[model samples]
Target: MKALIRSSAAVSAFILALSSSGVLIAQAATTGTTTTPTPMTSTATSDLTAGPLTLTAVPSFDFGTATLTGTTGDKVPGSSVTGALKVTNPGQIGGWQVTVAGTPFTDTSGTALTGTILSLDGLATNPITADDSTNTSTLPTFVTPETISTSATVVESAAPSTSTSHIGIGSYTTSYDAAASSLAVPSSTVAGTYTSTLTWTMSNAPA
Candidate 1:
């Protein structure tokens, strides 16, 4: 009887061990799960630009005065001195204006000389004609023709040429168009080295 009891006790212990293992396996299965997220990369690009450029004349002019020889009182018919007006455009793209600083005037005499440029009041003693040449009607016919009666020439300019403008009446006016690279001087100018400072303003236009 004692031996039988011992065998039965061993069998019961084995069954209990199996039941514990089954419970552990069920718990593991219920909690078993995995999750993963996707990975990615992004990129972008852009382009920028600017507008056209602009250029203009500066405000400063540097046409030095002339040293007058003959007297303004001793007016002659055809006696006249010569002078030049220095014009220029400061910008990459050229521009236009009526004269070397907007108008022409004899820095020495300060006379209203550029009246006849046609664009002005048309009262200029001299007016510019064709071929950059000067003429009378545009130039004043002095009482003393020998003392003061002369004409001027419009010195042509290349891309950007150092040109001269003639003015006999006193102060003359001119116009400029940068695009055209052209300048205008009075038709009736004197024969001296007249000068007017021309300043330019730069442009932003494409080269």
Candidate 2:
């Protein structure tokens, strides 16, 4: 009876130890941890650009009316007229120039008036507040009254702005004066009005 009881006690102790070892192994297998990596990012950029250059003219030049009291082959002078012209440059890096040309004055009959002369002078620019290095020392000068020719004449010119990065706006005001002389008064001088047209051109090229 004592030997059987000792055998039963030893078997029970071995079973309990095996059960505890199994439980510990199972808990250890489930105790591990895990983790994942995160992502990262960024961007790039630039500046806005400028637009094209532009030019405009206003107020047609009018020499006004004239009365011819002189005799045949005589020359008569007419009153002078004044007007303004504007130039706008947005993104131009270089300089600019302006020119003008006109057709001959003619009567309603399309008869080209002989000895007709037109003169342009007194060129002035506005916003003289800033100094431009490229400007001419003297403004354009047209002393002699020139007859209407096919070729155009340069009236004004300005260089690239040294003070500002870009030329914003520039204005030119000029005086127009004219004179008419009778080369040979016909036996019958027509009685009517005379008219002519003047065209102005602006160029990116400097004068």
Candidate 3:
């Protein structure tokens, strides 16, 4: 069999003489490398196990320190914490919800801010991921302007998912603005450092 030389060298063939069997004999010289193709295949596989459907991050509220003017005032200014409430879904076949409750604001001396309330306004859902393939409709639902109290109130929720459909199958984030996050001080309020505790809970909840 004859094969073509595929290299950067010149090939030459010269007729030398005739063979004893009445066949023409030739001499050939070739330089450089000859290449032959060999096929190669690669295989790879992966199994995606289920991940936990839960809250990934919860923002800490810091209404900071406030000073009282020796008289009755509606609200007082305080510091702010920068963050957003975050939740993640593991493609679970169930729904989920997040609730928030807060204890009354009190001073170091246990003096409660009786009529004071902590509120978050301009509440809304934000896109958790910037992936172009993410579906915007699957983000979680939320209730806005929450005046977090002692009772657990649902702030964000998601509908149940089925075998073929998903309501909240991706990560979600809730954005809230500081509208009026201050404590009210009455004329009788004792001037001192005050603090409050906020509790955020996540659980499995269906539509």
Candidate 4:
């Protein structure tokens, strides 16, 4: 009986040892550690471009103050003086002309100059007297008074055209080619401070 009891206790001890060893082996297990990798991505995206344009104008001629150097109201009857006029385009351009205009002139005494009509409608016509008859006789008269006595021609783009004695606007334009211009004071330019002025106007062409 004693030996049997001893053998039983030994058997019990061996079983307990086996169970504890199995528990330790299971608890000490090292799990394989892994982290899920994160994915990376990206997204991307295009137009027309152009250049700049520009114009400028400049007057080539300037007529300084014109004073009558001849005798008072004693201008040559049929002789003319020449002067220059300049026109320019600073930028690339095409098709343009200059037209001139102005107010009539008067004497230093503030008297409007007067003269007989030499022509009308491009023909000989009766004399058109001055508005202020006080100045009418101021104009020179001839024994054989022609239908037209005095005239003015504003030369530009070409030789000036003759105009009957009067106070009004006179204009001219440049020829086909863009060029400088000149004007011929009428041979019969009356004496006095003829306050005639020139103005330049621009245009594409005859409308």
Candidate of highest lDDT = 3
Question: Which model is ahead, 3 or 4, in terms of lDDT?
Answer: 3
Candidate 2, residues 88-162, lDDT tens digits: the string is 444455666666776766888898665555554333322222224554333322222334344676655656644
Model 1 lDDT per residue over 105-151, tens place: 35466644543221111112232222224421122111110110123
CA lDDT scores, all candidates in order: 0.32, 0.52, 0.65, 0.33
TM-score of every prediction relative to native = 0.21, 0.50, 0.63, 0.26
Candidates ranked by TM-score: 3, 2, 4, 1
1-207: candidate 3 lDDT, tens digit per residue = 134553212233222222422342222223346889999999999887757877667766566666667776657643565777777776665888889887887887787777666666533344233123656446566676567778888877788876666777777676565544455557676767777787888878775
Q: How many times do residue backbones clash in model 2?
A: 0
* Candidate 3 collision pairs: none
Task: Give the C-alpha miss distance for residue 93 in model 4, angstroms.
Answer: 5.6
Worst 10 residues of 4 by lDDT: 119-128
Worst 10 residues of 2 by lDDT: 178-187
The superposed Cα distance between candidate 4 and the true structure at residue 13, in angstroms, equals 87
